[model samples]
Target: MRGKLRHGNVPLRGIAIVAILLVIAGAATASATLLFLGEQPSPPQLAAPPPIPAPGPEPDHALRDGQPGEVGLNPAPIAAAQGQLAAGTQPSPGHPHPSYAGEVSLLARDGVVVSRQATGFALRYADAQGPELPAEQQEKTQNDTIFDLASLTKLFTSIAVLQLADDGRVNLNAPVADYVPEFAASGKQKITVQELLTHTSGLQAKIELWRLPPPARLPAVLSATPQNPPGAVYRYSDLNMITLGVLVERMSGRPLDAVVHDRITAPLGMTDTGYRPPRDKLHRIAATEFETDPPRGLVRGEVQDENAWSLGGVAGHAGIFSTADDLAVLGQALLDGGTYRNQRILRPETVRAMLTNYNTAFPRNAHGLGFELDQPWYMAGLSGPHTAGHTGFTGTSLVIDPGSRSIVVLLTNAVHPSRTWGSIGPARLEIAQGMALALGPPGHDG
Candidate 1:
């Protein structure tokens, strides 16, 4: 009875064993059912490492008038810079004439126009001989006064070429002869577009295109020979850009000036920037040198570069006239990676290529595709491997410091009365240093 104790006349021990078996079977069934229903327990999994984030795009800030403090800049140095510029307009000891006849300077940090100052007379001298114009007859320098861009025109030409490259219409590494077949003359068949852009085309510094008749000038550039082997040395040459202008015209089936206006200035809203500004805008134009050799007197409302003037004021090397404010917009656009107010003139990568130092083999002559880079002579405190700028013979400069996100533009008619007045190098350094100092130390917010 102890073993088989129940009412069914079966063994109690057997029943207990069956009950234990049933409980084991039920547990197994439940587990099987859970697994079949997709509720199976999973093995432990290690957590995944967080993903690395990509670098953010540069800020596309639009320019607006603001105080220096608004952009973490000290006002003292900037103010001092303004004083220096004002003093530059006055006669100094040793130098009988002012450093520049007139000037328009602009300093912008993070797209804010911290300082915009104008001083002196746009039309000061009667001629290149130092006779001052009668006071009432002279036009004072206004903030909007347009000055000849000189070599800064190279920057625009470069942008036009790069735009073609962006459009798959041109290859940088291709020979110049590919676009403008006439460029192949005089051992230039091997000269690459990149070499021309970087001034490493081994071309001579310049030719007297102005000496040739106007119709012969363009043809002369096409047949010009390189001074050295292609890519042998970095020689800043006007021929390189003149040839490039021809190439641009041929490839686009449009005049170089029209290409620049429709593509660059128009998109950037640079109302006062163009080659051969309209006759109506003459009153706002600054006067330049009085050329006796060319017999052009009081070169007002015209390009000052003899070669460009000879080219009908639309050459690639020097012709564009722009105000400090318009140029500031250009600097900001470049700083923001080639877009301003939603107008994308160049892709960010194209801009990167443009500002990249291609002439690394050349030491102090560091040059990008279309800009001079790390030029401490003019860049001063703002000089760095990434600092990009260009200086015009007409006493205009545009310095863009990526590290500081700042721009300093000093447009002066240093050659207004005469190119021999003095070197504007001191003024360039002062303005750049002022902006750099105002931004405080590197990496400092203020």
Candidate 2:
């Protein structure tokens, strides 16, 4: 039984191929039979799926029972974001986003790209050598250029867990300890895999992995205990994907990076997305905001999440690098129910499961397994019950709207020199709004 996409009543399809052949005992016998009776021939039977229906109003909004409607980014909110973009210009009294070299923002709606603009690049801070990016290095900041997605790495981690569920190697409702025995050390023994995916695992939000001496970190994780009663509340915990990473490694018997690369990145042809980007590709890499607490002046060609860095830059929570183009493919794949270019990565039902909002009682952190559902302040006007996407603290986000059959990806080095400046919420939300405005709302009745 195949389930249709819950967001919209998108149809499901199946594909099968068959070939038929007949053998003759001998050439002489065949010739003799041909002279008498024509070779035995039977009409080959074949089957084909129905043609795709023209998209109309989505037929279903799959949810547990009563998932709330998501907020949408309106023209007003979008105008406000653009206002913020303008202020991100020459540092003025109110502008928070310092003009520390930004990317060109592009708004795409429907199948059309509506708006594109370059901003926040002229201003700069001293580099490790206290030198600014020369004019040549600045070319990659254009609209066509790609920005590295930071901790948004969790999106891939979530996909991996769903893949395991599809393979029947793991069950979302089952306790995660079924695979990673060490994860059961604390009271988390009874926590279901779904709980972790939804950030309701009761695990500590973070352990300051970078602060601990290298040898003590793993021990720290093994000894982690729940901060709240499991499944009783919602708490965004990096520990969730961290555990998932361990589970993926244990089940696949390969490092998380290898498993993700082979299953998610490589098959999708996301050539620009991977863990620890190669040195050859580093030249085009955008510089993240500098940091001094860890004694690292400016972070480039390195993982940004401290926990991921502590884990040697391949944690399930945050050790992948990707660009807008590569991740846009990922977004499109999700929109297509996991297949792109004739390669089926995820079944329609599985994709449905990922987008279903499981957090009903916990309202603030609305989420599904690896995907965040309907949050308007960050989602801007794009929030809807069927809307789903995720954000990385490193100025990266992916938003998919089943109703529009559209996706928006924004990548920036918002934290170019420090995490202190301000939230890049406007930038992320503006990109989605630009796309929405470009696409325009559907229907003529209004």
Candidate 3:
């Protein structure tokens, strides 16, 4: 019956089977074409790709008491760093004693207090060559103990000048002679206010301002001749700041200490910070070196900077006494863009200008207005373009990292026994590194 239905030789069933086989072959070819060239073959379904987490806001910058872990920091490293710092304060066998007699260190991460350590003695010393004192006579260091801020006073002077600038009383670009005609002497008439802050004013690094009478010191600083042409060199000179102190006074018509207190410390609530701490607070002040030349033995309750002392303990280059706690507030204020707790001491723009490096011509000297910028020798892990700080000759240091919103204050009486006790660079680096490590990487807003 299949052969009868067929037109020519092949049977109908045979033709049907042949057509089915051809249809199957065509489908295989079409599938191959789709798989390789025409279109994609259906593949196995996969689980949806995991959602990426979105970044969050920055961590809170208002300092509060918290453990390192609370601020997303590792506790072990911070503890280890503290231990190392403590060890550095003690005398090791075969190693000449500690870098400093005592220290008070505070570390904050994202404005959270992670560590506060007070070690050694503030008065466990005497003259460099004097016999060791009885332990009973030495006073142990405390967190609130006041320290002579030494060159850190420059920061205050710089702030005062900036405050004047903010008030429109001072012009940074104007020549010093504009505000201070006496400054025109010694060919310094062309020097600008900014040149002094950047330490590029070519002023001599130092003068025995003490050698001159108190009345004459100010004149001497003003009459100072530039060792190099103005803005030609980067020289960290106390005279530059001294001249600024004079400028601040001349423009504001107020004493340096008075202006710093009324405008800075008082507003910031830095109760324990100021020049010439009161007589009642003298006992808590660290003792500095013995100056036989000036006959100031175990110098205590007085400014440590010789020139500043000679100028009656209230000068621009030095003489401010402060505690680690007080200095932390100042550091935090700068990090907060010159305001703290609703009190705006400096405009944000002024703060930025003060911290912006102007000595780009001299890369090694990365100086902002009054703050030293990115000094690796002391800033350690905290050293960066945004890191700004200053080291006091009295062994006090302040390091502020805007990126981390962290502040590290290390106050020491390295000058307690003697200013010749060796450098505190090692201890500074170690302390700063510890704090930086605890904070980990930046932008960990969680």
Q: Quick one: best lDDT, which candidate?
A: 1
* Candidate 3 C-alpha lDDT tens digits along 121-168: 888765577456897898888988889889889999999998887887
Residues 352-439 of candidate 1: C-alpha lDDT, one tens digit per residue: 6666666655666777678888776677667766679999999999999877788999999889788888578888877887787777
Q: Global lDDT of each model?
A: 0.80, 0.62, 0.74
Clashing pairs in model 1, backbone N/Cα/C closer than 3 A: 4-12
Worst 10 residues of 1 by lDDT: 19-28
Best by TM-score: 1
Of 1 and 3, the candidate ranking higher by TM-score = 1
TM-scores for candidates 1 onward, in order: 0.87, 0.76, 0.84
- Clashes (backbone N, CA, C under 3 Å), per candidate, total 1, 12, 0
- Comparison by TM-score, 1 against 2, better one: 1
Worst 10 residues of 3 by lDDT: 17-26
- In candidate 2, what are the lDDT values of residues 146-247, reduced to their tens digit? 455666888898888888777767666666787887778877787877788888877888889889999988668756988887777788888888888888
RMSD of candidates 1 onward, in order:
24.9, 15.9, 24.3
Q: Candidate 1 regions off by >4 Å?
A: 1-55
